[model samples]
Target: MGDVRVIEVKQSVFAENDRRADALRAELKAHGTFLLNLMSSPGSGKTTTLAATFKALRGRLNMAVMEADIDSDVDARAMDELGVRAIQLHTGGMCHLDADMTAQGLRGLEALATPDAPIDLAILENVGNLVCPAEFDTGASANAMILSVPEGDDKALKYPLMFEVCDVVLINKIDVLPYFDFNLERCRERILMRNPHAKIFPICAKTGEGIEPWADWLVASVRAWQA
Candidate 1:
């Protein structure tokens, strides 16, 4: 055995992360909380859409949010003003927030929930990366990925995994559709090919067009899961 030197590679990059995420899911399930992990490219209006969504769901259901980013808690601060329990997770230098990070974030949010009324909906605004974030589960009951018109419809083909795992595909910034070259038909065709079961919702987060249907679908989805 010439010099017999070997380095033990016992750790998985995502192993610990997945374990923590599974636990988080169990905890939320026990409380009957439905988790929605929102994914999208930076500036795709995911955070803004979340704010609008929370506004629409506030009185109707017990809601909370865990917003994750590489830096700055601005998104969390923005949601807090809307009167729902919300917290921010700074991923430090991590490009994508995994299960462990989300678990801690959810803990902070749990404290924000009312004592008598447990959380019904907990939306995780995943770190704004259209790629790596889609690989991890984050213990979300469903993954909702937003694709804006500015990003173009060809995105579904380029990032099939993201579209494949998504529970819903939201076409944001539709009001500006006329100004851009986004092809709606091509977008839907690609998404359906990746995930036929994924429900599609088109909306302009800035103008609030087609948001009600998305919100309604969300509310109904939560109720269905809870029931």
Candidate 2:
């Protein structure tokens, strides 16, 4: 019988992607741009939260948004209406954006940016799915995810990797906590168990409740990255 060889395709792919992600991070640092990778499940109000964030930091920072989706320019259009340099990235049915795809999106954003006002904060709204996005490094300065109250508190337990990779977790739709069975404290505990260093903010993206802290964190992060 002939000898069989084993190949670790997934491991090799991840290692290569990680190397590219690190290079991308260095490039972004040289350009003085802070990239944030935002993730969430579909219908998690990711866009609405971004709208609130834009409103909070509009004049304070030169910002741009790269909306990644399987297919759709709707989010990009919405962001454009908000007056930011917005670009839609079609992932061609892929559930996530790797470092190379994120770098390509950054180039597109660079073309849209003006000379006088370069992008200080570039946000990549990653494809809406917890599993695939968590497995790929997008070379973002930080990773954030939105977990709405309706999604329940046990999400951290089910999607441990998603919680572990996130630097911040926004508990959105807190206004409806009364109607939902979600426990804010328990959710925080679960998230902390998965990632002890994660900063959590319970917010209502619809009414702009509890957005100040989240926005403040972003402002600090951007400034720290640039400094």
Candidate models: Cα lDDT each: 0.84, 0.91
Error of 2 at 90 (Å): 1.5
Runs with alpha carbons beyond 4 Å of true place in candidate 1:
1-16, 70-78
TM-scores for every predicted model: 0.90, 0.93
> Which stretches of model 2 miss by more than 4 angstroms?
1-11, 70-77
Per-residue alpha-carbon lDDT of model 2 for 27-54, expressed as tens digits?
9998889999999999999888999998
TM-score of 2: 0.93
Q: Give Cα distance to truth, residue 5, candidate 1, Å.
A: 7.9
lDDT of 1 by residue, 1-227 (tens): 58888999999887877787888888878878999998999888987788778777778888888778745434555676776777778788777778877888888888887778788888888878888998887988889989999999999889989999899999999988899988898889989999999899999887888889999998898888787
In candidate 2, the residue pairs with backbone N, CA or C atoms under 3 Å apart (3 or more residues apart, or in different chains) clash, namely none
**Best candidate according to lDDT:** 2
- In model 1, pairs of residues that clash are none
Cα deviation at 77, candidate 2, in Å, is 4.7
